[model samples]
Target: MSVSEKATIICSKCSAETDFVAWKSITTDTDPIFKEKVRSGELYQCICPKCGNVTIIEYDTLYSEVDKDLTIYFVTNKDSYEKAMELLKSDEANSEEEQSGVFRVVTTRAEFREKLLIADAGYDDRAIEILKFITATHVKEVQKIKFDAALFDMQNGKYGFRFFETGKAGIFIPMVEDMYNQVVVDFSPKYPTEEKDNLEVNLNWVINIVKGNNNSFI
Candidate 1:
């Protein structure tokens, strides 16, 4: 189910207050247009009617794709993060049925977009994060180029990533299938044995796994 609240937002450029339908929760199955907007990073953009200036806004939203069994909490601050954690916990305790799916809490717009792309592409978020961590580590140690984020990208028939630095253009790195496959094979046994609800999988989870089984992938 999608939930939205109407609010009057003052445009930064013209100071014109525009009515905005802020989506608090989005269910992708019922709202394909919203899903596309969120995926393209344009969900929070508001165009000022008076000045035509585009303003990007950020807020906490719960995005869920029922078909994919994926739910993500896009949080912007510590308070929002805590609120999301509590909501997830409460849902787990009160729900009468269990739905095995991927649950994630992201603090950035880039991460929110990345998670959606990862889920849409049917990639394991864990393996993708592990791949990113490995690639980032390699670049830092060998190439000496520190990137802020490595976002998943698919072009033509290829699976690759676009690495972003603070002020530099994104550098594209083609996915190495062998490395990704090996990571899955190496870590599958240690991961969840049975499907569970709302499993938090991301960079931190991958880092912990790597630290414990450093030899497995390194």
Candidate 2:
């Protein structure tokens, strides 16, 4: 279920036009190796035959994990990104029949990677994002420091997170099970228990909570 298009791309280094297979959609169930290629960052890379230079293609692709019930559509082009947003907004009342699993709309390459990693690890990416938001709020309240980014990491059979501070590139603050469990416990009430068919609907709830609308979020 990996969809691709053949295109004649001009090599930036040698200016030689060569045919390349550009992947537009990838399904982990069918093309398993593609997931590894994504992790290695070689799937979107084209090696020029003439100059031997690597050219990175920035195009939109849908990354789907059927086993994990996740689908993330990534668009980098401005027009496509805006159109994707508009489509998602129009499908606000997205029917259960129209969905197979967690259908998330993403606009960046980093987000696409993060969501794919989380789904491959058998965890819910939306829930993890909510947990990160709560933990970031606590970090700011307690340590008086800004938490910029975080990614789920497993170390020594334990589920943890690696955090980055504002303006820091490689700064990581590792968290243990106790901290993660605390966030889960705190955010439990905000979870949408009724939407068992679509658990990610609660992501909007978490976003509203982040926007300072505690009572009206739900």
Candidate 3:
């Protein structure tokens, strides 16, 4: 189900108010046009009628793909996460049916897009985040800057990334195939599960394992 409503947006360039449609939930299976807009990131994008300024109107939205077996609650604020956690911990959360596949909570437009890209690439988003963490931290010359975006090239088996420096986006860095493969191989074994129900994984869950923090999440 795709839910939308008309809303007003202020233009950054002219400080003029404009009206646009904002989506509250996006189900990719049936509504592909909106889905394409999500991929292209134009669903709530608004152009100022007065000054031609472009901006995106962001709000809380649930992104789901039943065929892909993925559900991500994209929350814009901390309160939403707390509320979502409460829902996840309810009796419905204990149902065997609900526990069948990946369930996650993500914040930020970038992470929301990353989830879609990762699923499209037939790769795990958590694994890719770990790779991002490594790239942003351990790598030497690359570590000198912070990357704002990462795009995976499944065709070439490479990661295409860009960074924001002085309001400028850096070009794609050289592909690191070895590191990607190494992370996929090395990270999976950290928590091995024979059961099919346990296929979904995330960085927070991994962090819990490393920190010996035992908290229940599905």
Candidate 4:
């Protein structure tokens, strides 16, 4: 079956209001055990007038058989997306390390858990200090993460770090403590540069600091 309906969705980037027609349908099939499964749902789709974005809004069912509402969109044209994907793949294949002002710091997962414990004990200042130490001390090791950019997690507590390559970046930190305890660090390079020459210098610097030979403050 099919029915026409309308709904509104906010654009993720621009927050512009968008309206689209919704279609509803149903499906039926017989299981091998002779049981029949009946599925009925309303489907949604939207087209953004301002951005010319076309996307599926969702599908809802009375029985709650569907797991989630599905949606999709694009920020750039097809050509741009393809080109960007190509560039990203190339960067990954070549493993070219580009430096964005952002640096990625490495800490043991146990240390991350300890940091959370410190935060829970009301040692917010100490937690922050530890993070600062970890980031600054490991700056050299962070530079070797083989990415275009990286950043430390300063918000909340010391959770993990992020690495950026090609046109994208990833957060590799696990969430600990309450939902808010995970730290988020974002780094964007001022200008793109290669890490070939500086990688060794950074590695040695981080090694020295981790070995407690360097007394520099974070």
Candidate 5:
């Protein structure tokens, strides 16, 4: 059986302390290992009931040497996140640009396939354009992408896509290395810093995935 613990968190927006059950291992339909990482302390996130915000709780300080008590350092803006979520939920009814927020809308699977066919076609432009389209249509969905899997793991928690093998529903958009353009430097203060490290990594991985050199889904 998996063990769990109760943790208390204070809402950054409301300043109300709420209690949460921190699971040691939460088994789900997709990605069984996700819970293992959380149990191992490799990942940390929580949800606030008062404001209904799913916050990324950081246990250790960014540059702190001493081990301090784990605290709720970051509380995500639930308003925007939830708005983007609505767009994703209504993807089929919405246009390509609207679905862009939930998933990348390529012209066609052949377009992605052609890139794979080319000798030196890179994913930099394609990925950026797809992400940008999604951002422009549903700005909130861009932020909620990080928490979608965790929040909906039980129902349809598959990350981006189920697999890249072969099927219809369009090509499974692989996880790009630097998929994130902005990094949350501090959640308590609700500050964001532009960083390109994630984007660089995403490009490298997308290239490999398209070439079939790597099978690890982003």
Candidate 6:
């Protein structure tokens, strides 16, 4: 079920307060429009009626696709993450069925969107994250700059990643399927099943995994 409420938002440009629908939790099965908005990168936007100015608002929300067993918590900071965990625990307590599958926490909106795309494309997110880490590391070494990579799309057996905050922004690098396939074969067996909700599986997670396992996906 999708949970939402009417909230007043003060426009950044106009300083005008307006009523907006704020979503606390979104279920893709029941809220396709909201899901689409999130995909189109318009979910956190507020338009001022007086000045017609658009403001981007970022908040914590739970994104779920129940049938697919994918739940993601989009949180900006530690306080939001704690609050989201409390809500998730309460919901789990109230529910009769046991929850399973990929439950994750993403800090940024871009990461949230990338996770959705990964899930929709039927790719294992763990594998994709490993691939992203490898690509980002190579790029950092070659370009002498740090970059955050996200899964853009896959075509002709090549996975494309868009690097954020690079020297030249919006750069796409094509990673062949062989890299992803090798990661899955090498690391998938060692990957533990997610028993805890909101497991954060980002680049940091991958780095830790690589550090712990001597021969794991270097």
As a TM-score, model 2 comes out at 0.75
Write down the lDDT of every candidate, Cα atoms only: 0.77, 0.66, 0.64, 0.36, 0.33, 0.77
Model 2: colliding residue pairs: none
Backbone clashes, each candidate: 0, 0, 0, 2, 7, 0
Give candidate 1's error at residue 122 in angstroms: 1.7
Better of 3 and 5 by lDDT: 3
Q: Report the error of model 1 at residue 199, Å.
A: 4.7
Among all windows of 10 consecutive residues in model 1, the one with the lowest summed lDDT is 192-201
Per-residue lDDT of model 5, residues 99-215, tens digit only: 111122112223222222221222233344334333332423543322111100011332232111233232233333344232111111221121111111123333433354243
Show model 1 residue runs off by greater than 4 Å: 89-96, 155-157, 192-200, 214-216
Q: What are the models' TM-scores?
A: 0.86, 0.75, 0.70, 0.21, 0.23, 0.82
Q: What is the C-alpha RMSD of each candidate to the true structure, in Å?
A: 2.7, 4.3, 5.6, 20.0, 19.2, 3.5
What lDDT tens digits, residue by residue, belong to model 3 across residues 98-215? 3554666767776677777778767666566666555545443545655444443333555544444554656555447677678778766655352222223444555544454243
| Minimal lDDT window, size 10, model 6 | 189-198
Worst 10 residues of 2 by lDDT: 193-202
**Runs of candidate 2 exceeding 4 Å displacement:** 91-93, 96-98, 138-148, 153-168, 192-205, 212-218
Candidate 6, which segments miss by more than 4 Å at Cα?
A: 83-97, 142-158, 166-170
TM-score of candidate 3 to 2 decimals: 0.70
Error (Å) of candidate 3 at residue 155 is 12
| Candidate 4: tens digits of C-alpha lDDT, residues 146-170 | 4554433334544545445674755
lDDT of candidate 2 vs native?
0.66
